[model samples]
Target: MDERVTVLKKQIRAVVVAGGTDEITYQSEWLGYLPFPVDHWVEYQGKTFSGDFPFDWTLDDLASLERTGFLEKLEAYENPEDRFDRCIRYRVHIGCA
Candidate 1:
């Protein structure tokens, strides 16, 4: 397995162990199963926005989505110490992918 995938899995495990819940509405029919809430924020075109990350998505899927500039990672949300901290948040560019 890729090291990044391992790291991502660990991050997700930490968030779930910490009691994170799904709080955002499903954003895409193609992207299903978001186990964690979409609580992270990102700035784009001078506007801040939040988005959902599919819980079952793999890193390869993210890479494909990102190649189209449809997803942004919210690195600030990776802290496991924070109770609200969850898996890496992906700001999905809705309708684009």
Candidate 2:
């Protein structure tokens, strides 16, 4: 697992434990304007897709958590008219901690 993913998992665990909630959402904006690398590619369901900044890293990390049974994606929403208007809901599996 990527170190970033590990860090993210820890952060999520802390938040869930403190808030006593099993759900969390991941969302970000202005990624294209960020200084981070924008050239990222991901293959999902045999389709290749590309995204900038957080989108690139965030998607991969969340998928990793899901694969490890740490989280289960409940839903995802994206607005083509406003790229930043997007969010993904996930159920955190506290037991997996």
Candidate 3:
């Protein structure tokens, strides 16, 4: 597994959660900016937020997510069969927004 990916994910999460402000909270923004689909809700920073599908994307688009390091963390685990959903969820939950 690529330790870099795991480290990056944690770094991203830390930066996001630390950006909270009185008027706007970045904790939820990550989940909304993801370039993929999601289900009913997302949970992060010890809280839960509702979610909706990003859109219906083509195979090429889905592939691009992986090609572009969008799924690097999940891929590093080397369990595609089990981590597919997790890959998407992590993308949605940790997107930089």
Candidate 4:
């Protein structure tokens, strides 16, 4: 794999391991995934924010989203560490194949 991709994947995995919700967004052509929809759109700091996961995301894609204020409202609302601990286990057990 490309070094950048590998690096981003690792970072995302680490975030997931550290109790952050690390699901990929599918609204942009960043990765291939099913769409997660949003019901309401909100504006903050003069920018519009919605909750659609971008598609086929890479670090570059996420960075663009962050720059565009899409992730401005992102935050941990629960004990995500424990949730990630349980949820990330499934991902950890998966083989690259």
Candidate 4 lDDT, 1-97, residue by residue in tens: 4454444445434444555343433222212234742222222222333222233334354444344433332332323443211101112211221
What is residue 23's positional error in candidate 4, in angstroms?
2.4
lDDT tens digits by residue: candidate 3, 18-40: 65521111121123345853332
Residue pairs with colliding backbones in model 3 are none
Question: What TM value does model 3 have?
Answer: 0.24
Question: Which prediction has the highest lDDT against the true structure?
Answer: 2
TM-score per model over all chains: 0.29, 0.64, 0.24, 0.27
Off by over 4 Å in 3: 21-97
Candidate 1 residue-wise lDDT at 46? 31
Across residues 19-77, which tens digit of lDDT does each residue of candidate 1 receive?
Answer: 44311111211222377443433223333322233345544654554566555554423
Q: Please, what is the whole-model Cα lDDT of each candidate in the order they appear?
A: 0.40, 0.66, 0.35, 0.32
Off by over 4 Å in 2: 31-57
